[model samples]
Target: MYRNNKSNLKLMRLLPRIGVICCIALLLTAAGCSRVEKAEKDDKILIGLSLDSIVVERWQRELEILVATVNELDAEIDVQIANESIDKQTEQIQYLIDKNVDVLIVVPNDANAFYDVLSEAERSGIDVIAYDRLIMHPDVDLYVSFDNVEIGRGISQRLIDELKKKTVNIPEEEIKPFKLLIINGDPKDNNSKLLNEGIYASLQEYIDAGFVTVVDEAWANEWREKIAKDLVEKYLSSGEEIDGIIAANDVLATGAIEILSKWRKAGEVLVVSQDAELSACQRIVEKTQLATAYKPIYDLASTTAKIAVSMAKGEKIIANDSIYNGYDNIPYLKLDAYVVDLDNMDNVIVKSGFHRKEDIYRNINNGK
Candidate 1:
């Protein structure tokens, strides 16, 4: 009887083990079904956006408009912001690729980086769109941005006009050559190069004619405010006479303005900038900065979102222009850009509903 009781105890233990195995099997089956269901849902089309950095106000606006547009299309989009890290961005792209995203939109930190990984994504049948900044990769499917070159030209032209006004009182022969400083954006950014190209093109005649001279040039890393401020301060402390500055973007412009304002030279030095950030517009009203090249963020972001969704749905993409990225004439959708000064700030920025009038004119009386 003791032996029989021991045998029953062993069977009871075996019964518990068997029940545990059955429970595990059921759980595994449920997990497999969940994955299959997710796979089926992913078939509807998935878009992955890798933003270089939204640390700037401009990029934040870009993200907001892009997400709103994607939701309107009833499409799914996953976004990853790299905050200006190439390695982190590469890893993010890989994760999206592993998720089998149908389309990948990348605003690359470095134009030269990500050619190989983006190529792999292309090989996997994922459409890649270069957002805002051009990705110098042959595998990139499309480039969407405003005319950066035109923005450069516009800002440069505005500087030249302002310089002329500042020099108009002097005799033609006695006019001091206008000394201009060039504070470019991140060297790794392709848009910086394009902006420089346009600026140089527009200012070449004046430079050659000796009416203007580039006194100093520096490239701000990552468009960091402190770096730009230090560069400008160092130049100013050296007792250099700076009549004008062509700061690549508003953030860099802010740095230069801070230094110039501290030195009490903000009114004398003509500063040209881009991005039309709210602070820059206020500075324009304050007459501390000159014109800003305003590229409508909503237009660029909404259009890019639409393209990504359509491409994900296997539709044809028609580009308005072509840019050769060393390997191919990559299709491009270039949008228009405008120069905004205090005079038309209302027409361009406020009327477009981009910014509330009260916000832009916060520091000024009706933006003067």
Candidate 2:
């Protein structure tokens, strides 16, 4: 009876304290609910962007722009890097789907290969924005990227200009032939295919005149430089007197330079490529490589970010240009690119802050 009485007294004392705590907890929970409801009402969207990979510098810049923009709007974004693999890309997209994001921005691993999964995702009410590379599925909501054919044509024409500079003009005498080693990006990427076609088209006149011959051509397995290195090495081992290399991007150009440095001939073999990366600019300064197409990474990345955010906010993004997506004339957010040589390397790349003048001239004139 004594123990029972003491327990009852303690319970009575705790009753008021317990009630206060319970009331406070209930108040806090209600407040949290109200805040959440308000936030939801204010249109703060959550976006999930799954990128193929950061093989080039542009992807990182795009991520920065997107992150900054979302923060400005009091929104959130989830970014995933697939490192250029379809399986990883699929997994990332699935995770985004599970999160119930307001928008899905994807630069598909293979634009044509993800139709089934994208359809499934669409069924769940996800707004899909095909980024950089066009996702060919009929259900894709938005498409954004630079003019791939124009990019290709620009680079090749720049190379032709460079060749003209190096050429010893003769009225009718046969010129010292310049053999080319063409290295394109992944065969599955439609953009890469278009770019290669442009390159070939630009070189057709030279090819017909017997001024250039593609000694060896290669396709990067996954738009990677290592594959390019392997292919370039194989070509070198074949004992072909390669005069110039036409790699599709800066990474491939770096890979080709690695193999070209071991050439059996006398002077540096001319190399041409795209994506004026810092290293590529440095190479140009040293004369180890000839030229690169400085695709305005800033413009594309910034524009993609703005378009993505606009899509999330339900804004207009009508494209100004059109590109042939195999059968259909697909619209595009076309941006311009420039060719970077030693002459304009500073003006084009360094001035844009893509590269530094000091770093580019770190080791020139055989200053190992």
Candidate 3:
């Protein structure tokens, strides 16, 4: 009984110390978990930007401006380039969705290809913004880009105006209808169809008047420069007389211009395209390309970033316009576009600091 009593006393004495040790360990573990939770709660807002492709120079500029704007707004951006592949873009979007991004911005390679994935994103509670190109899905929260129809109108009008200038001295009745070649962008892109609508609308009056004839027109696959080059080459090789070309964007314009150059007809054939890429601007100054439709990228990118941040924070977005995406109306915020040619290139492009004057005029004598 004495031994049993002694052992009981010893165990009793050690019980409080073991309890204290356990209490201390529990407190430490709780503190570690709290720290982790707090860190996660304080993480910066993450914006997932899925781009169709950065193959074009303008897209690089837009990316730089978007990153800068997002950083300025105290948010983090994750960019994924799809290289103009619909399947790849869809997969990238899924990855972003799995990452649980606060906001998802997509410059879709194919407007209609993301219906299922975008639906998945919405189901996951992620806000989707169709950047530059409209995603055909109705679940898209916002569509931010320039007025694409106006861009088409502006570039087409420029083509018509240039043709008018070339035949000014000749009588209207005696002048033959100018032969025009239309090299449109990827058919899968919604913007391309909208652009064609505007192009045909702008050219209707001229076409009715028998002033312009579309000799050959085709949609370039993936907006590939080589595809555009091949299209123009094939047309020229058939001995067809092409007086003007309406290239959908600068990349296509570059391809078309290359074929024209090979035929020693670069400046002789009037060509107009969209997206004021640096190379396109240089071509304009060199008289190889007549004009380009310049969408103010800084304004577009900054506005998109701000809207995206606002959407991420559950803030209300005020948009004056909305567009129907085949199912529902989506908030549309459009910016203006400008026509950039030699006459106003200095004022619009160089003055805006979009490109350096020296770089645009590098190939020209006396920087004319």
By lDDT, the best candidate is: 3
Q: How many clashes in each structure?
A: 0, 0, 0
The digit string of per-residue lDDT tens for model 1 on 49-106 reads 9988888999998999888898888788899988789999999999898887777899
Please give the CA lDDT of all the candidate structures: 0.85, 0.73, 0.86
Error of 3 at 299 (Å): 1.1
Please, what are the lDDT tens digits per residue for candidate 3 over residues 1-368?
11244335435544565576556557678566665445444567889999999988889989999999999998999999998878898899999988878789999988888899998876766778899888888678889988888889889999899899988799777999989988888998889988998899899899999999998788987887787798789888988888889999998999899999999999999999898999999999988999999888999999999999987766776476888888888888988999999999999999999889998998988565
- Per-model TM values vs. the true structure: 0.87, 0.82, 0.87
Where in model 1 is the C-alpha error above 4 Å?
A: 1-43, 366-368
Model 1: lowest-lDDT 10 consecutive positions? 1-10
Model 2 alpha-carbon miss at residue 240, Å: 2.1
The TM-score obtained by model 1 is: 0.87
Where in model 3 is the C-alpha error above 4 Å?
1-41, 366-368
Between prediction 2 and prediction 3, the one with superior TM-score is 3
